[model samples]
Target chain A: MDELIINSELHQYKIMIGNRIRYDINTLLPKTYSTILVITDDKVAEKYLSEVMSNLQAENIFTSIIPAGEQSKSFALFEKLHTEALTYGLDRESLIIALGGGVVGDLAGFVAATYMRGIDYIQMPTTILAHDSSVGGKVAINHQLGKNLIGSFYPPKAVLYDIDTLSTLPRSQVRSGYAELIKEGLIADEELFQSILSSDLMSLSQDQLHNHIRSGIKIKAAIVEADEKEKGMRKYLNLGHTLGHALETTLGYGVLTHGEAIGIGLLFSMYVSESVYTIKLPYEPLYRWLLNNNYPLFLEQLHVNDLITLMKTDKKTLNHHIQMVLLKNVGEPVIKEISDEDMSSYLKQFLRKLVIA
Target chain B: MDELIINSELHQYKIMIGNRIRYDINTLLPKTYSTILVITDDKVAEKYLSEVMSNLQAENIFTSIIPAGEQSKSFALFEKLHTEALTYGLDRESLIIALGGGVVGDLAGFVAATYMRGIDYIQMPTTILAHDSSVGGKVAINHQLGKNLIGSFYPPKAVLYDIDTLSTLPRSQVRSGYAELIKEGLIADEELFQSILSSDLMSLSQDQLHNHIRSGIKIKAAIVEADEKEKGMRKYLNLGHTLGHALETTLGYGVLTHGEAIGIGLLFSMYVSESVYTIKLPYEPLYRWLLNNNYPLFLEQLHVNDLITLMKTDKKTLNHHIQMVLLKNVGEPVIKEISDEDMSSYLKQFLRKLVIA
Candidate 1:
């Protein structure tokens, strides 16, 4: 097992990445809680809930299984989970275990964040997409207005990333989840990026997948430690997220999985970066790589004007100026404020190329 | 104007208390924001919205007004505010000014807390009850099952407490607000407690009210600074809140103002203290004081068992044990976990006395 510690101004927690790390949960807990509530999605619960529950060492244990997918990250579900926690008599000393992918982790992590003005929770991520979401402690529920519009930077007590669970994920989900790993490489680690680009992401050996996931988490952990609130350097972590979020919002959440939207976003960001910086980037190769992986890269149904407007509403956008993370080099990400005229122009060129291809 | 600095692990904020401090808002802002959204209740907006709007120094200013009272702290309103914020193009660099009493402060503060994963907000408390709520960073919205069940401990950038706003409050509201000031005294400052006890709380002069409010904020600031998350010393600030919250939840919120419920809780905590610790408390004199001030001191509409059941669901309760803040003496407070049997007996005795009186 590989272990890493995430340091935020508010908390310092560990991330354990290995095969079947779920069983090590007892050893990872900071202390014994009064009661433990495991929050997962229905799909994840059907697969691993019983196994995880049997391994948890707590006197009183309860489970709240939400419907699987991005729709689960809604205010209605957020409220329902809190009601369930209260019904189960979960208190200050209680623990909430968020078990599943990004949707479950984000929703359940947020429930723990605001439940009684915050309590301890562990992220037991069961999908590859969760490799990024579970580590950074950026928990939130989507607002009707935008994705992650209502959220908090509340860190979890610990994260147990059991690779064994990833075996159940479908091929499309794996491709979607791998986009974040690619994002991690593009932002900070060129070697990791090159390795992922060279390898067939769909059929990586268990050991190879473990190394890439560990690298992605370490890069994220380092950035979060320096800027937990995203006042400065942390904004770089939103590499493709500005447009990715806009796409997710424009498409209506769950129309495209978060990672799939991000896969398209990564290509658009690279195109914008090359245009804005007048620098050469592996834009074509990366685009071809995404297509090869079966990522839904075409946004023919949407207009550049709509996506631009939605991008302005992004959390990263400031003063209604679309601030996008663009790469000057493979490992160098810069946040540039793109005016509507410039953003619309770049977005048009990028979308036009997608249509041609 | 009197200034007190509240120190928390996450952030440090200032509390400016005086007559008409609302006009001094621009001076108190830590920095200029991109946009400013003022969130207040309809009642407060009628009196001060235009004046506040005229005084605020921002290029873009927007106001979101909700219905007055505790009902405003619902999930519906919470979601509405976030939607309004997004509609107005408020972003990470924008600020939210909570421009009413506790309801507005809590709802707006929670919006600011989770808006774009937290942003800068200032608390412009418009009532005496806010003297306590405004100082602490405990921001939240109410759940259907309980009060403040959904929330975060995100502190404001600053607090502008204008004593001038108190003149608009009704006599009942004054009595309701004064109970918290009295709680501040009972838990900490004996001299402040004695001064308040001797005075006619209903009719204090401007200078006297300013001094008492400042002192209350100082006591609270000290406690919050020592323990921001209510992990230890901060729980002392909940001296009257355990039963106080139970009463508010039982009474269906807004039926009894928060401070009024707290006034009754103060009396109950004293009663429990006397029973469990075998110590003398000024229960009778305090009871008479509450009656003299026209605080609703009777619970004939409710049963002790129902309140007890509700109390068990309190955020402070641990492992199904009712942990309450009890005064050992006038100036000292301690948290004691009372058995269900002891709690039921003490609650019945306290109610019986209230009935006879």
Candidate 2:
């Protein structure tokens, strides 16, 4: 297993990334903690929790499972976990192990952060999508009004990214997770962007995939280190999330995977970059490439004005102004305020042009 | 306004304690942030939100009010605040100002910590009881089965303790809050303990009472500084809290203020400490002192077994062992693992003794 140390302004934690690393938790977890409470979702608990449980061999390991999906990451579910943690006897010395994807990580990490005002927790990511979500100490739950509206910036003691579990993930989930990789490249890495574009979007060997995942994580770690709270440079990572969250909320969260919504949002941001940012880039070729790779742009179906209204609820929006991360060029992003008129006009042009294609 | 900077290994914050200090929020708050969101419970919001809003005159200032009670300090209420915040256009640059007592401070501070992966927030304490709750930054919500089962250790940007608002608090609430002062004295300050016992518990002059409030906060702040995450010294703050939470949960939270339940719990813990540690103290005097102060030591009403069962849900319990903080002697506390048999027998003796008196 390869280990990466992420040293951010708020906290520093170790991330273990490799195959079958979930069973090797003892190498990283603290020996003093007598018991562990592994929090997971119904979907993942049925599949992978027992394997993780046997590996830890905890004197008193407990499990609390909630339903799977963004909907389950609510205040009600959080309360249930809290009561369960308390009922099972979690103290300062007890560890919380989050054993699932991003939703599970965010929710369980939040439970750990708040349960008795913080305790140690380990992340055993069960999805390829979690590779991006599992890193960067951002833990939170969604409010009905907005995506990820309630949460904390609490890091885990260690992250066990067992790649072997990724084989169990659905194809759509894999594609969805890959969207964040594209986002990492769009913000910082020119070489990574080129690599993603050149390689087959699907059907990659394990070594090549791991290299790509590590590159994405490196870029994210650098951003988090620079600004753990997203006051400045960290906003770059929200390249597609501002619109992506709006789509997820407005279109209904369960309708699309987090990465899939972001994929569509990323395409819209490129168009914004092309028109409003006025950045010179190879846009036509990139658009054609996405189309070839089966990225359904969905421009013809979505309403522009309605989308802008939904975007207002995003955390990135400042003072009623809709702010977006627009690409100055490939591998270069800048936060820009988009006027409603300009955004609507741009969306109209893209819809007309894409429909004719 | 007296501004005290608390420098701890994990957290550092300024505590501004004085009268009518809300006016200084602009100067007291971090100059980096632009917007502010005032969070309060419905009771305090009705009385004081306008005053708070008028002082911190920002174009983007917004107010959110939740139902007032321990019941409101749940995931449901937290989600309400989260949704309200999003609706009000809160962003990373925004600040959340908690304008009520413990419930507001805990819930709002939690919302700030979680919203957008952590934002800045200030505690503008409106009630005298808040003097203890506002300072330490232990923000949380209660689950259905237990109190403070879900929470985080995110300190506020600054705590503003305005003495004027205490005038609006009912005598019952003020008396309820005084239990914490007695608790503070019991654990660490013999001088304060004697002074409180000698003074008129219900009728101390405002200026004289503020001094005690400040002293209690000072004691709490010092303990928090020594151990921000409750690894060691901070556990002393949980002196009455373990059994107190059980009493509050068992009796039903609204039936008693947090302080009242803790008051009863304190007596029980003292009895347990005297027996377990071979430390003898005058039980009659202690029981009489609590009665004179209007603290109801209803040993006959509550079942020992039920209280013990509820205590098992406390986060302080490790591996089914309830680690209770007991008074070795007044001003010295010892956290010891006690069996259900020991606690049950002690409760029976204490009840029998109270009946004879």
Candidate 3:
């Protein structure tokens, strides 16, 4: 088993990664909670809830099963979970366990963040995408207008990443999850990025997948430790998310998985970086890699103006200026405010390139 | 203007107290926000919205006015404010000004705490009751089941308490606001408590009120600074809130203003303290003062079992044990876990005492 410690201003917690690490959950807990509330989605519950519950030894145990998907991260469900916690008599000494992917982690983490003005929670990420969401204390529910529009930076007590859970993820989910690992590489780790470019992401050995996930989390942990609140260097983590979130909002959530949308966004960011900096980049090689890996690289003929409007509304946008994280080079990311005219022109150019590629 | 600095783990901000300090809002701002969203209730908007808006210098400014009172601190208004923020193109660099009493401060502060994973917000308290809420950073929206069940401990960039705004407050509002001042005294300052006991709470001169409010804030500021997250000494501030919140929830929120309910909770804590510690207290004097000041001193025909149930569900309750903040002596508070059996009998005795008094 491998463990990485994440240090934030409010907390310091461990991210334990290994096969069947879920069973060792008892060891990772900061203390024995009087009651334990495990929040998972219906899909994950069907597969792992019983096993996790049996392993979790607490005097009082309760489980809230939300419907499986991005839609679960809504205000209604967030309230429902708090209602459940209250109904079950959970208190300051109680603990919450988020036992699913990014959706559960974000929703449950958010519930823990605000429930009784904060409580202790642990992240048991069942999917690869959660590797990114789980480490940082950024837990939130989506508003009708945008994704993660309501949330806070509250860290978890611990994160137990059981690799055994990943064996059940669909290929699309794996593809979606890998996009974040690719983001970690593009922003800060050239060797990791180069390794991913050279390998078949779908057919990675258990050891290879484990190593990459660890690398991604380590990179994320360092950035978060330095800037827990996203005041400065943390913007690098949003390298592809500026356009990535717009695509998710425009395409309608769930049409493209978070990572799938980010895959296309990663390509767009590189294309814009190359143009804005007038520097040579390995754009064609990366494009071919995404296409070869079956990442949906097309924008579905969406209007550039609509995409620009969505980008302008992103949380990262400052003063209505769309701040896109572009690569000064691989292993280096810089935030640049793209003017509407420049952004419009860049979108047109990128769309043209996408069609030709 | 009197300025008090609040230092927390994540932030350090000033609480400016004086008459008509709202007009100097520009000088208190940390920086020029690209846009500003002023969140106030309909009632407050009618009285002070235009004036606050005129004083607020920003390129773009927007206002969201919910219906007045505690009902505004609901999930619906919280969501509505986020929608307004997104629609107004408010961003990370934007500022949210909470321009009302505790209701607006809590709802708006919560919105700021979560919008785009938190933006900057300042408290412009227009009511005396807000002297407590505005400084603490305990921002939240109430759930259907409990008060402040869903919230976070997010401090504001600045708190501008304009004593001038209190001129138009109703007698009920004034009485309600003073309960918190009484609580600060009961927990930390005997002089403040004795002074309050002697004064006609309904008819304090401006200077007396100012001194009392300043003293209450300084007491609160000291506790919050020592324990920002309420892991220790901060719970002392909840000397009355355990039962106080139960009263509000039991009677239904608008029936008795928060401070009025807390006033009763304060008496109950004293009675419980006198019994549990086998000590004499100034219960008679405090009780007489509350009665003379027209603060509602009775619980109407509510069952002890129901109130006990409510108290058990309080956020302070640990492992299903009812934790009440009781006075060891004047200005010294201690948390005690009251047995359900003892709690029920105490409630009966307290009810009987109220009837006789």
TM-score for all predictions?
A: 0.98, 0.94, 0.98
DockQ-based CAPRI category assigned to the predicted complex of candidate 3: high
CA shift of A344, model 2, Å: 2.1
TM-score of chain B for predicted candidate 3? 0.98
Worst 10 residues of 2 chain B by lDDT: B281-290
Error of 2 at B357 (Å): 2.9
Model 3 alpha-carbon miss at residue B278, Å: 2.4
The best candidate in terms of lDDT:
3
* Error of model 2, residue B53, in angstroms: 3.4
Q: Where does model 1 exceed 4 Å of error? A: none
TM-scores of chain A in all candidate models: 0.98, 0.94, 0.98
What do the candidate models score in CA lDDT, each in turn?
0.88, 0.79, 0.90
In terms of lDDT, the poorest run of 10 residues in model 3 chain B is B311-320
User: Pairs clashing in candidate 1?
Assistant: none
Taking the tens digit of each residue's C-alpha lDDT, what string does model 2 give over A1-357? 777898855467888789877777776674557888989999998888888888776688899988999898887887778878877877777899899999999999988888877888878888877887788778888777777767777878778887788877776787777788888888899787778777765676787778888888888878887887677888898888877887788788787788877886787788778777566665666566566666656543777778888877777877778888988887778889988888788767766776876
Per-residue error at B243 for model 3, in Å?
Answer: 2.3
What lDDT does model 2 reach? Answer: 0.79
Preferred candidate (TM-score higher): 2 or 3:
3
True-vs-predicted CA distance for residue B356, candidate 2, Å: 3.0
| Predicted chain A of candidate 1: TM-score | 0.98
